[model samples]
Target: MSRHSEIKKTVLRGVYEDNAGIPRSTHGKRQSKFAADSQEPVHSSRYPGKAVLVAVLGLVALLGFNLRLVTVDVAGPAAMQVVEEQPLPSYRVQLPVPVSPVGALIPGNDQLVSPEPIQSLDDATITSGRYDTMLTRLGMPMADLFNLQVQTIVIDPGHGGIDPGATGHLGLKEKDVVLDIAKRLRDKLAVTGKYRVLLTREGDRKVFLKERVAFAKENRADLFISTHVNSLPPGAGSLNYVETYYFGPHTDQRSLELAEKENRDSDYAMGDFREVIARIGDTLKTEESKQLANSIHKHLYNNMKRRNRGLIDAGAKTGPFMVLLGVEVPSVLIEVSCISNKAEEARLSTPEYRDRIADYLKTGIVDYLEERAHRRTIEGGIIQNVAKQER
Candidate 1:
């Protein structure tokens, strides 16, 4: 071959042949033509796959960027989610301590002697009504009415100090009115020398419901009487009456409302009342309390009516009073008068009227004790006969 032709073939081989042995003569010629037409020189390399790889990488990056934009646009804003907060746990309520006069010890001379053993009686002749009638007709020797002699009585004046309960339109506080009556009652009972009387609080001070119960129990009281004055809403001016309550489930809405109001004075939260009521229902003296309440209501109504002709008969009621709960003896709460009424408030403010209330309450207490004694006497006789038969 000619030297010129050999040199030309060598140059062509360098430009067209790739390292991988692929022919790129046509691509090289097109690149050379493009370089000639443009101002810049064309670059040719043996590794043509590198250029293709770089172009493919650029295209993949652009496609990934576009896909990311599309994904962001399609997703938009996320839906707002709401999560409810959980309720906090309930805590126990703590009550305050009470301040009151300490109980006094009874003297040995004040104690009564035990009764003599009863003579054997025939059971065949004993019927409920006939036995009672015989005792009444024959005038049987009256022994002590109770298994034990009644001595101490506790009179609790409901609400005091910070708790000025059930304020009347004329600024008469239930605490003050009930305290005054309670003092009168205590004085009257004390003067008799037949019974020892104690007051839960002698002065105006805050006394917790549980504290009052504790005071009565600590004193070994035979009977518990809580005094309170009733009040109505401003709209219920005409609804004036006196009511008595014993510890039990409330019968009416009015009784329930009164209980709720009376129970509100404690430092403890009212939410605990449901638990308190449940507990009190199991521990109350149902029949004994009811009887005491009836007696007190009867005497109180009759006595008050004598002075005030239009006095209402607000019948004996059962309510879940916190103050009356946990009392060991027969317990009753008296709503002495409706202080909400203009006329009744005026009457209740008088010393003479309050003294009358105290007298009626004392009478009721005496009546209950007498009836209890009579029942115990008959029971004692029956028990003696049974003992003789057993022997």
Candidate 2:
């Protein structure tokens, strides 16, 4: 054997001698060679773990800082927005200072005046008599604080010429009857000299609903009264009565039907008037119109009752009457009598009955005007007192 083989055998002999193994000669030589041929062992250093932990912490810190900046940037403008959306304050006026009392004696006068004639502040009197004269000139009620005095009245005779309203069994036309009544009313009111009465139509002629309302506005009327006659349909049982109406929502089905009937004319249908009526439906003089209707209705019912024993009082109703729209004044429609009924028709045909209606209607107008004047007197006094205090 060579020297190298001899060295290896020597190492094996030592290993076998120590362990007393039988195969140590070949196995020990192979094991020593395999161990010598292997690579060097690697060692883990503490710096690598520390470096990983530091890098993770740095990344976490950077993310946390960026999140804080995002939160502030998003929330800052929203916070400012709330502060910017506030309303401005309203304006206030400065009031005038009160004045002191004047000297008891007249200025530039040397003569000694009686102290008894000089009234103290506590003895100052507030007389309403002065306001009454001013209120009367304005055509306002003298006794009421807020009342309108009637100066100009417009009497509208419903349906004329081409439009012959409702017809009676006795050949009496509604247009003719109402026109005569209107003329009589105009004449009666003219005699008073207190009111400026004007008729919408002088003779039997076709007058549109719009024209009637326009006339009242053009004349600057304080009150508008439209006269008409009520009639029942052929199927409806005879309903003979006197009723008054003001422009408003219909009170009942009957009032609506009556409004529909009265609104119909040869020149225009219900459709045309509806749009016009709706346009001017919001009336500022609703309360005044109601008062006028009630006043006229009461007098009509009371006066007609004396003449006709079985006169039915239908009371005041509210209906959308085209003639009453856009009047710019207190307006009412008076259904004098039921021309469809034989007995009522006979009465309406007579001159005496028409004259009676005209008289009662005039009385109602005068009463309303006087009451309004009385109300104005009270209002004027209050306003005068306020003016004096302000001064």
Candidate 3:
């Protein structure tokens, strides 16, 4: 080849070519046209290695791109492309920490909650990334914690407004009696100013079971107290007793009946509600509630039995009442006195008797709190000893 042709060949070889030997030009740039000759660039398909090299180079360039964006077209018959890839935002999923208007959860290792605990079925958070929660590494509440203090309480007066609950014994309305007892209990707790107390209803007004639960959950109640009067079949022999309940599967037919009655007007679908309740039943919430029930029932029966000799100790029982559902803390429903029993109804009607019930409730609460504090002390000591050992 002549010197000029050699120069031309060298320049043509430097030009970027695709698999088809098509030279791609930069904008506003023109290639030097040469006479048609045998030295013209051959199709890369003729040299399979050249075509492979071109594809490899395209992939390499795509990877080295600053944006790291790419679109591969392996089977589309289209060339590989660079695309602006957007990634989804990453977030940290955190479980809710309890807070209340009356008292925020104080920073402590003790993670105590109420006896009537309810967990939200819809509290799921979708997130990506490493979140550092030791207790809830598996999206479960810390069952080992003992609350350091009982600060906020929600008192629920069952049956209000048009729903008069059980109305059979001596014309004494459950709505009125429970409300009265709740108010008196609220007053008793408030007088000490040691606890932040709130009532679900102040007067005879309609409040749905869900509403009561929402109120407690919203307020981040440490303890939830639901006051209700129990009723037996009208002819069922004078069953006068004081019973307390925590969230659990009903233990008896009577308990199931009570749960059905209390669950009236609750909007939750039975299937979904039972599923959620069953899930919660196996967790710390249920266990804590049982503890609270035992405490309150002990106090009520121990103190009240002496005052009223005929008072039956129905004992602390388990029932799946709607009012107790979704409390998200230690909570209990107290059947202070059976409304079906004319004798118990007569006692519940008096102001003095209601005041006494409030006092008993307060004692139960205070006792539970003291027990909680003592537990915190013991747990704290254990943790400290473990740390020291590690050191």
Candidates 2 and 3: which is better by TM-score?
3
Give one digit per residue, the lDDT tens place, for model 1 in 141-215.
Answer: 222322577788999999899998878778888899999999999998888888889999889999988889899
Q: How many clashes show up in model 2?
A: 13
| All candidates: TM-score | 0.60, 0.59, 0.63
Among all candidates shown, the one with the greatest lDDT: 3
Candidate 1 segments exceeding 4 Å error: 1-146, 266-284
Clash-forming residue pairs, model 3:
112-147, 114-329, 114-330, 115-289, 115-330, 115-331, 116-330, 116-331, 118-328, 161-205
- Candidate 2 residue lDDT tens string, 41-107: 4332312233443464356446542211100011122333443465222111111111222221111
What tens digits encode model 3's per-residue C-alpha lDDT throughout 263-302?
8788755555667556554444555566567667766876
What lDDT score is found at residue 13 in candidate 3?
Answer: 38
Q: Tell me the deviation in Å of residue 309 in model 3.
A: 3.1
- Considering every candidate listed, which one attains the maximal TM-score? 3
Candidate with more favorable, higher lDDT: 2 or 3: 3
